[model samples]
Target: MILLQANNVMRRFGADVLFHDVNLQIQEHGRTALVGRNGAGKTTLLKMIAGITSPDEGTIAKSKDLTIGYLAQDQGLDSQNTIWAELDLVFAPLHKMEKQIHQLEDQLASLDPSTRKFQLTTEKYSQLQADFKKRGGYEYESRMRGILKGFGFEEDDYQTAINSLSGGQKTKLALAKILLQSPDLLILDEPTNHLDMNVLAWLEDYLKSYQGALLVVSHDRYFLDRVVSDIYDLDNHTLRHYTGNYTQFMEHKQEWLTAEWKHYEQQQKKISKLEDFVNRNIVRASTTKRAQARRKQLEKMERLERPETDDKSIHFRFYSEKDSGNEVLDVEKAVVGYNDQKLAGPLSFTVRKPQRIGIIGPNGIGKSTLLKSILDRIPLVSGTIKLGANLQIGYYDQEQQQLHPEKSVLNEVWDDHPNIAEKDIRSLLGSFLFVGDDVYKLVHDLSGGEKARLELTKLSFKPINFLILDEPTNHLDIDSREVLENAINEFNGTVLFISHDRYFINQVATDVLDMNALGIKHYEGNYDNYLEAVNKEKATNANQDESQTTTTKPKKSSAQQSYQQSKETQRARRKLQRRVDKLEEEMTVLEEKQEAIKEQMSQPEIATDIGKLSDLQKKLDKFTTQSEDVELEWTSAAEELEKFDQENS
Candidate 1:
């Protein structure tokens, strides 16, 4: 059953069209995700769907009885009510029913059992009891507790005033209330904003079992991978649906774009050949007739628009102008906090050259404090922080408080490096996606994402041997996060960073140090590998087994049989390589057809045919699925070939 539908929805701001001709449907119990780069109008479309705003044209039809709970990007509960009080309000209807039940009980006591009034009273009382049980009246407090606990709140904190809570705490309370309300359609914009990994995992499980449809907008790829089943991508002033989570959406989108680019390139080639022929032979007597005929055919042909690839992200490498010593940093028995307080005590760690160490912990656990201590912006209560010789530090503050709000984006970087030309500074800004008037925007006016990019722009140009980053991926979209990961991976220096982004840690961190108010626990691998190890240990303990091997099994083949195995590997490699070759050929043909359909869609005569347009969209979606599958198979085959060769050697 369809719960909500938007037909031909369009949203425009004066001359700028945000999105148009968008059509979507949310079915019962559907799990949909809205994703795009920042400022691509995802939140705007979400508002339209949630009825906070109306579309310029088209209709949004919702189920007559549908109840919705929408959580905006900056959700907060601002009231004098305590945490428990705020949450209890979600059960207001149940409270009213409870009051009615109480009154009925009193009336029943006064009425005679033999009267018709007594009989009717008993029937009503029984009906109310069943309704109360069905609506979870009995478990209301327990349910509230469960939700609060899942959001990293203790029972003791439940009665605390919401006004006294932090901004992030208020946001969590708001979300908890929405969850308890349990509306038919739950819409969240960036719901994963203030969630830590542990709370994030719990919320994922909580959302999975929810008896309602979900539409979410979040940048947490790992969380989305665990929750959403469908993706609604807002790009190029339109919404496109893909049948997968964030990772799968990325794969499908890349494949679709590849096919589209291929089509455009093929069309351009044909046009180039025809144009060359017309220019070369149009004036000649011998080939003039044929040239004129070619020109006419070219004019009749519909031109395919070039794929937009104007997305600008920072592209830079990190290298130390001077190499630091082998021991980049050393801290022993450190107590990190402000004044006389201790956030984490007896914390000892050493950072070596070229080691990318990721610091992870729950919110307000002094991860940032630790970094500040090392930078000497704050003092350590106990242990000494030693830096190796010839060291230069680059720090990225997550709050972006280090930036000068009064300065323009151009002047922010230019003031530091006065020797660099103004044009050069603009060029650098362009790499970070700050182009034209964007560079003139004041730092205070920049979005969180823009400020992050600007900070990165400054950090990259610095000749630093060690970097200390605090929640560096805080406001970055997935693409920018990946770009930062790439830069960090390639940097030939030591790095100690704090991040809640598990995907970013998995890609860049060589080691992870789990911090808390107590102390730290180190893991010697990526986030996924660390979790695997932890879970495996837990499973062993739960099974009451202490003898399970944590090490990987060795290869069975011996040195004596190496020659025979090498020959076998060669044959396998050849087979896999042949498969890759075949997939490439199929990809080319699919791409050409993709472009042909796009050209047809762009034709002015066919554009007005709604049925034809819908059919083309469906066809395009099919092509995307097929192209992704082929690409995946090809990648696997290529990897298999490489692995076989490496193993045989």
Candidate 2:
């Protein structure tokens, strides 16, 4: 069943049409994600669907009793209410039903048992009780607790005043309320804005299992890929539907666009060829009939115009005049926290030149604090932070409060970097997708994403050797995020940034700094490698815990003992096999390099001269790096093999 349908939806801002002739049908249990660039009217379309705004030239038809829960990007709760009270309001109707049932029960007790009124009252009370049970009223409180907890809210936080909560916390609470409501349709804007990985994973699972329809406006590609089954791309004053996750949508959308451009090009070529043929032969005496035919073809040929693509993709390249020293930042015995509650270390780590580190933790777990401590915005309780000589730091804060709201976008860029030419400034702004009148728009009027882009545009103008970005991808759309990610990847300087975006981490992080209950642990790998290490540690811990628990238990039977022995033997064999595999890989690399050297030696002129000998020596030096890497691998593999053999013996 179609839950909501919009026909010929047209929205305009003054003389400019935001979207026109838009038709959309949302069926029951549909999960759709709306995607577009910043200022592409995604939020406006959502507002229209939620009835907070009206379309100038169309109607939205919603099913009767089609309860909708809409969470805007900027959601607010009544400041007077506590978080618990705010969520409890979602179940107000259920509470009312329970009260009415209690009243009926009292009336039944006061009535005569033989009376029809008494019998009817009893029947109604029984029905009410059953309805309450069916609605899970008995388990509602527990369910709410679980939901709130999954959203990174502690039990104590439930009673916290909503007014005291930060903007991000308020957004989370609002989302929790919506989840508790469990309406027929859920509309969320930028839902993953403040979510951590754990909370995000929980949400993805929850949304997957959600019974109702979902329409989300989010820039988190990973989140959309996980939760949304379909994508609605709002582009060029229209809506286009793609039947897949974000990744698949991107692939198919590009393929379709490519095919469309090709078709347009082919038609243009045909028209141009016909016009040329007609022009050349029209006045020729020898081919008047052919000329007439060519002219007819030219006249009949339909012109194909290409659809306009956004010319405002920001081309970001960081300007670093010179490289910093080997060590970019070093922290020794750093103790960082607030209000006497310490989060993580007594930690020490060094970020070398060309190092890209990702700082990850839960919502309030001091990821931002750590960044601030390094930046010297917050005083470390103890320990010293050292910066490399001549290090230039470029920081991108998530809030973007650094930008003066009164200034125009162009002024914001030019005010700080006056050395940049007007033409270059415009080009730089255009690269960040702020072009023409867009650059002229006041900073105060820009959306969060737009402001973020503008700040990035300004940052791109400066020369810096080190970057400290806090949630850099916070307000960016998917495309903008990609552009930033590409820029960061191309950067040669060191970067230490905090981000919850897994895709961005994978793309940019060369090292992982995980802040947890224990101090920050440095892993010499990206997010995937960190996960693997974490999993391995977890498995090892679990095995130790299981072994200790088993040892404390009563002695097992012979049959159980035999099973345990077999399991241990199999584990040892698998470990040995893994080591053998690594050694084999190392041997293969060594053989390949040796073969390459032999081939190089087989060259006739290069074999006998001093110049050739020098060239061969350079090749040998190049081969040494590869050989060293393989040797390291082989050593580790050999150690693992020996350890496994000793354990078995």
Candidate 3:
């Protein structure tokens, strides 16, 4: 049940081969991940597998009737239809069937019951009903609603046009549509880019139940660990498969590289010994035959090439001009936003010396704005922000706002440090992996990864005691991110940064500032520790919930409580309706008995039988009493149901 396979696949850029003779296969319900460095052509390989691009050298085989759904990196949904309408399109076939069923119903009602056309229409309606039910027509809307909610879209947002959403929201909408489609093979590239923790967790749960093959390309290690089981490492113009999650892959990869390099080194030493013997003895008169034999053997020996490795990663550290005071920053009742509209914060926080704080929140909750407000790049809506003595802040904008796009890569850094010698500046740029021709390239022409590297280069040279970064790891590759993390961890400076990379936060953050509409709250620990605390608190609250289920007290999570309440209301209404139906059934039996009793009483033979008439009269009285009681019970149940519905609604 292999859905797709790329055999002897080759992809190239100009004359440079990205990967050659790469073979990959995905089963009908397999999960695989394609991982490599940023410039290792992972995306190109994905496009080829997705059928959006053709392989340069080999053919891609697929099972007949294979449906592939590809969600590109940051692919946005731009449509005139509302969010609900866009999602509903996933069930287009079912929707068409629904319309056809209605038409058949109309035809059945209008046609004569005895006609052949009526029978044919009835058969067609039954067939359509079966197909529609198989396609989940009855529950598609509810599925759409649930998936949308999981992606952070509320019921009210369903009516909003797709084009009206932000880029991140649109990307999420696209992901939701693909998940609903449930194609045989799902190829997703960086699907976790814009999702918050809530959405990310929901997606993990959803994908666990997805009945399709998944081939994903992402740098989110935690996401990879949770979602994928196998890893395809694309390195040095080839692909190697590894078993297990991201953490396991790292361990296995290191073991493989070690073994490979060891074999190569052993062969190299043997070849060196043979060459030395041939060189020393071939010129001598003695042992000429032996030298000839050695020469022949050396010529015949198969040489092992050195193991390939990507080692030219950026290496630099934050250089502090001087240590700042004990208190680096102070904010009292600070509101951060644009104009008069507040995104978050009528809040307070302190950044002490050398404390690395990571800011986290949902998209558009003003995490970046908070950084700018503290730096005084944008005006605060209210209150005060104070910087302590001997503070020189270095800011890294995720968008690369600090760099001049018109300037060369070298000049972007050199222009800021005009006093530095040209040779020294070149040395600094070289350390950041901008060497020779790379330095001459304009900042605008640099790729996202390059821009990030260049930014880090500039930041490393800055003598600052306070670093404020907004999404600093946005464009960095896994290797560079790790290097940056090391630098940040080692830096003796105060740090405040906004990031959605949980791995990065976990690696570098000493404390986390959870931002929301209400304000920012401080948690003392790394991201993982904070999550543990939150989960522990949830479990505690859940235990309390059991005891307080009958109370009117408010719950910690309003959303969870509301969902539980709605489920309970639905259950109660269903139970009440069932009781009403039972009463109706009982009443029907009693009425039928009464009709039989009356008919017997009306019979000419029975009219003369006084004893039979008395029996019939008693039976009629019993039936009447039973029917009246049933009617009362039915009325009471129905009334209670109505009242309950009103209260809940």
Q: Residue-wise lDDT of candidate 1 within 1-649, one digit each (tens)?
A: 9999999999999999988888888989999998888888889999999999999999999999999999998698999998989889989989999999999999999999999999999999999989999999899999998999999999899789999988898898889999998999999999888888898989998998899999999988878877888998888778889997676788788898999999999999999999999999999999999999999999999999988742656677666788899999888888998896888877888899878899988888888889998989999978888988999899999889889999999999999999999999898889999998999999999989999999999998789899889988888887899899878866778999998887778667778998887788788866765776677767666675455445432334353144234434544554566577778878887888889999999999779999999999899889988988888988887887788768765
> Against the true structure, what is each candidate's TM-score?
0.82, 0.78, 0.81
lDDT of 2 at 230: 87
Error of 1 at 479 (Å): 1.6
Candidate lDDT values, in order: 0.86, 0.82, 0.86
Give the clash count for model 3. 0
Q: Can you write out model 2's per-residue Cα lDDT over 174-256, one digit (the tens) per residue?
A: 88889988999999998887788899989998998999999999888778866787888888778888997787788778887
Q: List RMSD in Å for every model shown.
A: 17.1, 10.4, 31.3
lDDT for model 3: 0.86
Top of the candidates by lDDT: 1
Stretches > 4 Å off in candidate 2: 107-117, 280-303, 338-343, 401-422, 434-447, 544-649
Error of 3 at 350 (Å): 1.9
State each candidate's clash count.
Answer: 0, 2, 0
